[model samples]
Target: MQAYQVAELTPGLGADERREFRDRALSSARNPSQFTQLREIEGYGEARLSLIERYLLQGTPDASALAAREAVALSAQASQYAKAMEGRYVAALLLMRRVLLGTALVTGLLSVTSALRALLLWRSEMDRRARREARQREALSLASHELRRPLQSLLLASDLLRHAETQEQRTHLLALIEDGAAQLASRADLTRLNDLYLDVTLRPRAQDLRPLLERFAAPRVELSLPLEPLVWPVDGDRLRQIVENLVENALKYTDGPVEVALREVGSQPEVTVRDHGSGLSDTLHGQVFLPYDQGPRGLRGGQGLGLPLVRRYARAHGGDVTLAAAPGGGLQATVRLGQPAGTRAETQAAGGAGLLQARSDAG
Candidate 1:
C-alpha cells in the first residue's frame, strides 16, 4: 500500500487528511499484530498510530504526532503564499510592458514633430532667399535706368560738340559734353555692379591677398604687408571695393596718415585699415556699417554708402569686418577671410607666375 492508497482508504480525509488517516488506521486495530500490519502500509507511521490510539483510548497523544500535523499545516500555508506571489509577479510584468509601450509611442511622436519643424524651417529659408533675389534684381533695374539716361545725354552732347561751327561755341559745347561725360562715368554701371554682387554672393574666386592689397595701396596712403603671401577664395571686385571704400573713408575722416596692412591670422587672411584721426564714438561703432548710417557728428559730405558697402562685400566673401580703436587712438577696420589650401611650393609649381603677374596688374 502507498500514500495514495492510504489517502483513498481514509474516511473523511478532506479535513485534516493526514491526521484522519492516522486516526482511522489506529482505531480499527484489534491487537499489536494488526497495528504492525497497519504500520507496514505506506504513510502509516507506527509512532503516529500509537499516539492516536493513546489519544483516543487512553487520552494521551504524543508530542511528535502534534508536530507532524503542524508541519503539514505550515506546508499548505506556504503553497498558498507561493501562488499569491506568482500572481503578483505576472501583474508587475504586464504593467512594465505597458509603460515601455507608452514610452516608445511618445518617442516616435517627438521624432515626427521634430522632422516636421525642420521641413517648415527649410521652406521658410527658401522663401526668404527667393524674396531677396527678387529685390536685388529690382534694385539693379532701377540703377540701370538711372545710369542710362545720363550716358545717353553725354553721347548726344559729344556728337553736337563735334559738329559745332564757331570755335567759341564749340569750346562751350565741349565743356558741357565733358561735364556730362564725367557725371556719367562717376556713376557705376548697373550690369558691372550686379555682376560683382553676384560673384560675391554666389561663386567666389580664388585671389592672392598680397597682390590685391598691393593694388589698392595708393601713394597717398601708407601700406604694410607680411613676408609671406596670404591667399583665399573671394570675390575679387567686391574685395577691391571694400578696400577702396575703407581707404576713402579713412581719407575723409582724417587729414592725417592712413595705414593698411594684410597678414595671416592663424588659418585666415586678415586685412586691417587704420586711420589716425578723431576715433569713432562708442555709440557709433556698431551703427556705422548699417546702410545710410552716418556717424555721431553726422559727417554730411557722403551719402553714407561707404561703410555699408564694405560690410556687405565682406559678408559676401564669407568674412566679417569689425571697427575698433586703433593703438594710436584712431579707427581700425579689420576684415577676416578663410585661407586658401596650398603650400608655397605647390602654388609656385602650378603656373602661379602668370597669376602673380595678373595679380600685380590688378593690384
Candidate 2:
C-alpha cells in the first residue's frame, strides 16, 4: 500500500531513488511467512510495486493504468488478512484460559485430601495415648493396695514381739516376726521383677535344665523328665523365676499336687506345669496374665504380677506362655523358649546378674 501511494504522488522519482525503494520492498517480501495470508499479501504486493516501477521508467499511460488497477486488488487482500489474524489470536487466548482453570481444580482437590488424612491420623494417635494412660493409672493403684497387707503384718508382728512376757511367748512372737519379714522380702522381689522384666535382656547359655527343675520337686509337686540332661540355650535365672512363679501361683489357688514336666516340643524347649485342682475359667485365665488384673479371686496373698512376669520373660527369649484346662481337671501352663536363644538376647536390654554355674544338688 505504501508503494502504491508513493507511485501515485511522485511518479517522476530519480533512477537511483526508484531502484533503492524497489530493492528494500523485494527484500521484505522474500522474508519468512508468519501466516499463509500474510505471505500471500507480501507476494502479491511485490508484483504490483514492480509494475508501478516499470510505469515510472516508461512514462506511458497504459503502464500507469495497469499499476492503478493492481493497487485496488492489493488493498482488499490486506483488509481480509487483518480480520483473519484477529480471530486466531482470540481463539488461542481462550484455550490457554481453560488449561489454567483445569490445573487449579486438580491442585485444590489434592490439598483437601492431604489435610483430611492428617486430621484422621492425629485423632487415632490421641485415642491410643488416652487408653495407655488409663491402663497405667489402674496398675499403679492396684500395686499400692497390694503392698499394704504385707506392711501391716510386719508392723503387727514387731509390736507383739516387744510385748512378749515368757520365753515361749517370745519364741512364738519371733517366729511371727520372721514370717512377716519373709513376706515383705518376697513382695519386694516381685515388685522389682515386674519393673525389670520388660526392660532387661536375657543372659542365655547352653546348660542342663534338669537340675533346675529338680529344685522345685517335692512331695506336693511331681516331676517328669526325659531321663537325659535336657540341654538348651537359656537364661537359667529367668527360667527358674518362670517355673517358681507358675508353681507358687498354682499352690496358692489349689490344695492338690502340681506336676512339673520338662521336654522339647519341636526345636524349642517346653516346660509344662499342671495342677490337679479345679482350673480357672477361660475369662479369668486371660485376665490373670495382665499386670495387676487378678480377676475375681485376686491372687490369694499375691501382687498379681506372677503370670505377667512369666509371659514377659518368656517373650524376651522370643517365646510365649500359654494356659489351658488339663484333660482331667486342672490348669496346665506351658512355657516355650525360642530356638538359637542367643539371637534374641542381643536385641533386648542388658539383664540382671548372670546365673551361678553350680547346679542345685537337691532332688
Give lDDT tens digits, candidate 1, residues 289-308.
77557687666466566676
- Write the residue-wise lDDT of candidate 2 on 1-363 in tens digits: 257336545868876775565455444434435335555565544444445445545544465456555555656667666666679888978975775565565566566557658878999999999987775554454345434555776788778878878999988878766755655554345445344344446667757788779878788999998775666667776787788788988887689999999997895579999987778888777788887777466777677777887897788877899999998998999998874346545323433112222222211
Global lDDT scores for all candidate models: 0.64, 0.68
Per lDDT, the best of the predicted structures is: 2
Per-candidate alpha-carbon RMSD to the true structure: 21.6, 20.0
TM-score of 1: 0.44
Q: What is the lDDT of residue 363 in candidate 2?
A: 17
lDDT of 2 at 168: 95
lDDT of 1: 0.64
What are the per-model numbers of colliding residue pairs?
A: 1, 1
- Clash count, candidate 1: 1
User: RMSD in Å for candidate 2, one decimal?
Assistant: 20.0
**Highest-scoring model, TM-score:** 2
